[model samples]
Target: MNVIHAENIIAGELNEFEQAIRLLKRLHECKARQYLDSWCKRGEAGVYHNVMRKLDRMGNIYQPYADHETEITDWFPLVDCIADTAVYNLKWLGRMGQWHPEALASLTAYVCEQERLQAKEK
Candidate 1:
């Protein structure tokens, strides 16, 4: 468990909601550090070219990384897309009203199990 989880656990226990939230937070931290953050340091134009190469058909959405100095311009849509993606997740919480407790318990357990498997692989 990370500091986030350790700080939240009280008397060897955490409420389902808090546990699930912390688990997802941990998952995000892992992905951002191991994968997402490295995208900008890879390939020809780095993150820009890597993503645009795959999104060529969409003329409006994709732009070639011509000027490496202004790479931040190419990364702008990513921030916009993140906000859109965050809003899209509202449906899940909206649907899990009455089943939140058990659902969160399962979510936390599933994340912990996956982390264990991933760590063992490493």
Candidate 2:
């Protein structure tokens, strides 16, 4: 998914951290589906398992944010974790020529914009 789609999901009305996670989850699902389709078409279904594993790893990184006790004060650290995982996932996808550069760029831009906006509130 692109930044516009992410923005639409966020609707600029929720907590910034929550919105960011939601967008990331959506993008992860989209990327997973893209990889699945590409691998299937190539008759390399075995490789799809690797993609799922990476996605699962990303999900593990997101677990803390999924916890109800996570505070707003934890936003930056959580975002950093997500950024790291996303970069790792993108790099592997790139090696396989399955990466969506535009989507990655858009998501990065959106995250930066959110960070800026949230900083202004403090």
Candidate 3:
């Protein structure tokens, strides 16, 4: 996993972290049920558990930022954690041959948007 140090985060970059959290929450709520249903029907509950686990990890990583609104330093790890979880979840879904088009699109869009923001920073 790539670690993003707090000192490396630029001013205003925390907005991207906030956006990522929102996107992850939206993706989880929108797709978790469908994924759970599909995985359960296919007797692949383990895969659903993995996906939800990543989402839970993301929530845990973001909780600090959500709780301390003024503490932008905490956003550094949150950004990397969100990125890692999103990428892992997408890859896991793909590997399981359970990719939902809409969910994939949302995840892809989040990655692309994050990349764009990072590029602008550089």
Candidate 4:
């Protein structure tokens, strides 16, 4: 009976730990999205006939999708640009060096370690 009670305590702790991990990951995901959105905002140009021509020099800066935004008047055109930007930023961030699983694992480990350290502080 004592062993069973201990096991249940462990299981409950694990569940709580898992929930904390998920919440941290969700917040990180939201932060990453906001980062991408900020980058995308830089692409948005006013509707002008010479906008693309003027923004042509922006290609030298190696941004995510400035070219797409030069002419984007609606949401449909942005889909491909955002996808490309995500891939570009992922590569730029060194995430391409490791696959998705490894990236996720590293993020998870970082979050877990931070949580552990933070809990120790309080």
Clash pairs of candidate 2? Answer: none
Model 4 spans > 4 angstroms off? 1-72, 83-105
The 10-residue segment with the lowest total lDDT in model 1: 83-92
Q: How many clashes does each candidate structure show, in the order listed?
A: 0, 0, 0, 0
- Name every residue pair that clashes in candidate 1: none
Residue-wise C-alpha lDDT for candidate 3, range 1-122, written one tens digit per residue: 22333444554555766645555656556666566444344344555675577678778776666898545665656655665467445546564444457766787789999999999999
Better candidate number, 3 or 4, judged by lDDT: 3
**Cα-based TM-score, every candidate:** 0.27, 0.29, 0.35, 0.24
- Model with the higher TM-score, candidate 1 or 2: 2
Residue 2 lDDT, candidate 4, scale 0-100: 25
- At residue 16, give the lDDT of candidate 4: 53
Task: Kindly report the root-mean-square deviation of model 1 from the true structure over all alpha carbons.
Answer: 15.4
Q: Candidate 1 residues 5-112, lDDT tens each?
A: 355456347666666555556555666566654544543245345445434433334334443433445654743344233322432343344436688678778999
For model 1 the TM-score comes to 0.27
Better of 3 and 4 by TM-score: 3
| 54-119: candidate 4 lDDT, tens digit per residue | 344334333444655454355433433433444334433444234346766777789999999999
Colliding residue pairs in candidate 3: none
**Cα error of candidate 3 at position 75, Å:** 3.5
What is the C-alpha local distance difference test score of candidate 1?
0.50
Better of 1 and 4 by TM-score: 1
